[model samples]
Target: MSDLLRRVATPCIGVCSTGIGDDVCRGCKRFCHEVIHWNSYSQEQKRIIDERLDQFLVQVMQDKLHIINAELLAWQLGVQRVRYPAQKDPYIWLFQLLRAGAGQITEPRKYGFVVDSVWRDSSLMELREAIDREFYLLSQAHYERYIGRYMQKEG
Candidate 1:
């Protein structure tokens, strides 16, 4: 589908932590206001939000993983029926695979990636948590630097 015709999918994985009043959600790594207002956002707004998230995941994975085979990664995501946005950066697809079931994967090579040498020894489950933690923190930092600053100035 064309970008204009296609809707940007919500990042929610059904593990929302925003109800407890978190500034950023743990599941999708979106700011709390973003989650609450997602359905109301215009297509362009949604796309911007999605892009920010994709960039965050890409940043977190940059040092920790390497996609050596883009074709294989695409094929594996399809073969495994991983739910990811098509036509996105391959790193986003890699993040989706990790989010869906990192532990289920034993040899990332089969999925077309190799964990960095430093993280190769870590269990995929552990790696998944670390990635998630970093992503959330990064989102939180951005929110504080931008939104929070705006709010503080306005208040």
Candidate 2:
């Protein structure tokens, strides 16, 4: 079969609870509308959305973790049996790294990462909390902007 004929797998982390008023998916960080309409989107459109999510993840994660050698990191992930999206986004890998390493991450450089001092100094739970807070704020802002346009149009 042609590669183009194969559909790209959805990045659904399986925590899809978009039934509420959440404008974003908590697991994958995809916009709720994007999640709902994913199966209907053309490959090019899906790619575009994936790229946007990648950009957002990188923007948020770069402040907390720095990737050194992406190839080495991928190798390490394989060795550790850590599951993450296979996309080229380093930030997603970093998320997996953080989850896998947690308290065990004493020398992040060895894992091809350099976590922020704030994260490095704190417990993994603390880091996770901070990341969640930041991501939630970002999602809320995006939701307001997206919904505001529709609200404005109706008024």
Candidate 3:
């Protein structure tokens, strides 16, 4: 029995959140009753628990992949408009990227007043152009046009 116990062992990540009263792990969804009786359980029981855990992790990873793919599709559509545009303003699609940047900022003042005003405007295309212009100017590496100390030299 001892040899079997040693051979039928499983791995634990030690983030035990098995609910005290619920009889199930709040963190990993493993049953608390199974956990409490882990030593007494058969090898087959442990295998079933492990399989269930693997399935749960796979679902979590798949959901993340779906979200990432959706964002990429939206970006690709926006890019295609820029590359082969029949309209006067091919670059108008870039406003979505700028609006996205505004949302990602942790601090409000980092991007400057022009960006802030664009975010406030009703026209999404105009807002996108404003952001693109800002990006182009900044990419030139000039500090004069920039609001603050733009890209300081590393020590």
- For this target, which candidate reaches the highest TM-score against the unseen true structure? 1
lDDT of 1 by residue, 23-64 (tens): 899899889889999999999999999889989999998879
- The estimated TM-scores of all candidates read 0.91, 0.79, 0.33
Best by lDDT: 1
RMSD each, Å: 1.5, 3.0, 23.6
Candidate 3 deviation (Cα RMSD): 23.6
lDDT at residue 142 of model 3 (Cα atoms): 27
Model 3 quality (TM-score): 0.33
Pull out the clashing pairs in model 3.
Answer: 95-128
Ranking by TM-score: 1, 2, 3
* Model 2 lDDT per residue over 58-124, tens place: 7788888778888888888888888877656877887776766666766667778777876677776
Instruction: Give the residue spans of candidate 1 off by over 4 A.
Output: 153-155
List, in order, the clash count of every candidate structure. 0, 0, 1
Task: Give the C-alpha lDDT of model 3.
Answer: 0.40
lDDT to native, each model: 0.89, 0.75, 0.40
Model 2 stretches with alpha carbons more than 4 Å out: 1-7, 85-87, 100-103
